[model samples]
Target: MRRMRVAAAMSVAALALAGCGSSTESTPGAGGASSSAKALKIGMAYDVGGRGDQSFNDAAAAGLDKAKKDLGVETKEATAVNGEPESAREERLQQLIDAGYKDVVAVGFAYAPSVKKVAAANPDAKISLIDSTDATGPNIVNLTFAEQQGSFLVGAAAALKSKTANIGFIGGVNTDLIKKFEAGYTAGAKAVKPAIKIQVKYLTQPPDFSGFGDPAKGKTAAEGMYQQGADVIYAAAGGSGGGLFTAATAAKKMAIGVDSDQALTAPPAARPYVITSMLKKVDVATFDFIKSLTEGKFVAGTKIYDLKANGVGYSTTGGQMDDIKAKLDAYKQQIIDGKIVVPAKP
Candidate 1:
């Protein structure tokens, strides 16, 4: 089973790379806009995992690719040093602005202060920060996702798929944002099976902020949960989730992934174990915002994309998920039809 899982993981990785390569080279922005016609220069800064973790960074890159192809925009990207200071992030943003990239998209909450400050300094530049709420300046747009709604669906799935009724949640940080995921997940699991057991763990407490990149901690947390008799686990720990997946695979248990389609992100041994993922449409949001810039319809201030807007939901593909797909679809439609209200905060 382990060897088969490894083979499957390798296949998924190859497919993902192929998908990325093909999509990235096609037209460069939305609608195949002419790059020669006053090319719009854009830059993006990634969060902890950088580009290849196959999660948030990759989703943002997908948006940039769409912008490049459809809108004919020139783009560049910068990586954050893992476990580094926020000052380094700020310096990179400044460098991008200084290099004449007028429109910038910073990919994580860690970039909030830097994005706000940089946007304030360069009034002419348009900046959008995803997964963060600190961009309140005139030139910056804050993009926040309704991750709770999607997490609710995945949580429900975890409850349904669990043979042991005991589940676990591992988070990157213990912030209100990450708590939103935990709260929704807990609520969703309870909604499905009121007696379900959930063991919650956080990779970091207050002030550390290393939770997102700490896979070692995530692995330890997952192993602890497994020892505690959790048969299914849900990870909202960014790069840390990779460790959780590894633990699940090793324990021969199941796990639920987050952010992007984690069924594709995790190693093969964890793929079949990953029943489904909370699909937060970061790529779509990024692409749409950049398209708005091209069409002169760029809206400033905070833009919230929730389940109702198709900006977030649960994944249905990647094998062994067909049985739960119908239920997920029904729940999704109910949410859209105003029959269900998924909470945004814990």
Candidate 2:
């Protein structure tokens, strides 16, 4: 039954990815029963990639669903349209708050400023923002992940799986958040294979966040790495990772995914090309936050998810990862035990 459910979910995700179906919106009261006497009201605003990137935004949506079921929250969502600027996110956020949603959650670092602004104006409201710590309002809860630990595991996997000594990294932007993934990945690869060669590329330079959602440019960047003899490419570029996956599939190389279990996100043509994924448990974080709010234990401060708490790690699904499961499990244990320290910056 578990396997069947996984299959069904994968099928739905594939349909959504193919544009044949719409993104799934969580229905209020979907979660079994509310543990609290009062019904919770939750709102989520997605980053530029909207909800179908099969990565961060999707994982956040999953958490909202769990919240709706477990806490009887009435949920609402606002997705960023394609080509929308960071400034536009503010409008969407304010719209949700104006509609009377008390617990608003923003799913990307880009939403930090908007969340800060909105949370301040609505002090009585509770707000949560993931992948960012910039919002310091008393009404806001900032959720961050120790992404370095997860990237370390996958970086090691990339090194072990590479037929060539060269590995590549493609990021959405050069911000500290994305750098955390690159730095950790590089360090992990070097730790496992001392002589490994790394090629790093960013989709955007300073002041440009649009690159995170541009898959075409990501594909172009990845093609250059493939030409330079990189056998494995790890992408932390949100929707842009789709292009990296496309390039990897065409080149018959390996691609490491981010945020969620991306083995399930890859197109059929690129499925076999994915080596593994660096996972940040965004869904768990979302559900946990909503649970806290429902229990009246919501705190306004920075909350971190790290390896010791199973908040971040690598994938354990199908394909090449299956063959390396034992070794990966051992590495994960070592990291959790403090025997390994992954770098957070490059």
Candidate 3:
């Protein structure tokens, strides 16, 4: 299993290099924009928690920061406010556009409509909308991730470590996007133990994305799962993931984090409970998108970050997952080898 994993991981690395080889030859920015601009001006419109959420938003911020450092790019940032009307989203994105930001990246799927509208209004602007699969426009680049592929790895790890043969999943919001996490996790857990008990819960539903930020609600939901016999839980709830970490610590259980490496970023008290994180490689996507734009290789279509491309994987930090690396790697190889097709829906 370990050998299979190493070989599979190597394949992804090689493919990643080949995959990015021609990104420079992609379609020019809208209006056949030139890369001779005075400076690389980039803009970021973050989700509710913005850069400090220690989850999804933070991952995006990492990429933007890398761009600023490596490319010496000038940047503008916009924050999301809960329950705000769609007009507010449009205004936030438009503010950056009007501010002369040549490349603007919207950080969440909720910005789909606004991105579509804004990108259309500014046909010459370079727009990258994350987590969006559709929304056609001249310069609109949809950035999506193979979240299910990564989620399955973490689920298998949880199953391997669970003496109770029970695990849990907590999603921030009930949407097609979050469902993908649940589906992949359940499949992976079952694959490992065949009869592993999986508990699932959602923090909130659409039109109410507050679940991503409500740590209290997250703690309560995770506590319920833990009480019901789940020894480990996977959290895909953005900032709310912090609450799951807290619950894991208090219950003396384990929690799998998402997006960034939570073992390094979670609060000191909760960090110990974080066995591993499903790395979504948002920073890579963000930096690559900006890099493409600056180099005039900006493509105006969907770019998928999937396991085969090393865009998603499970973190092996802190050595907590070392004991099960072979098992986890086997599953990873299977997914990359097309032996396992992780579902994007529940």
lDDT of each: 0.85, 0.86, 0.89
TM-scores for all predictions: 0.83, 0.83, 0.87
Where model 2 places Cα greater than 4 Å from the true spot, the runs are: 1-38, 80-91
Model 3, global lDDT: 0.89
TM-score-based ranking: 3, 1, 2
Clashes of each: 13, 1, 0
What are the per-residue Cα lDDT tens digits for candidate 2 across 1-346? Answer: 9999999999999877876433334443475344554677787888766677677888998889888777688778888876677678888888888876778888888788888888888888888889889888788888999999889889989988888889999998889889999999998889879999999999997577767778899999999999999999999988889999999989998899999888887898898888788989999999998899878898899988998888998876676787877887888888888888777889
What lDDT tens digits, residue by residue, belong to model 1 across residues 83-165?
A: 67878998898888887777888998989988877887888988899988766887788889988888888888888888889
Q: Arrange candidates by lDDT, highest first: which order?
A: 3, 2, 1
Error (Å) of candidate 1 at residue 27 is 25
Better of 1 and 3 by lDDT: 3
> Which 10-residue window of candidate 1 scores lowest in summed lDDT?
26-35
- Give model 2's TM-score versus the native structure: 0.83
State candidate 3's TM-score: 0.87
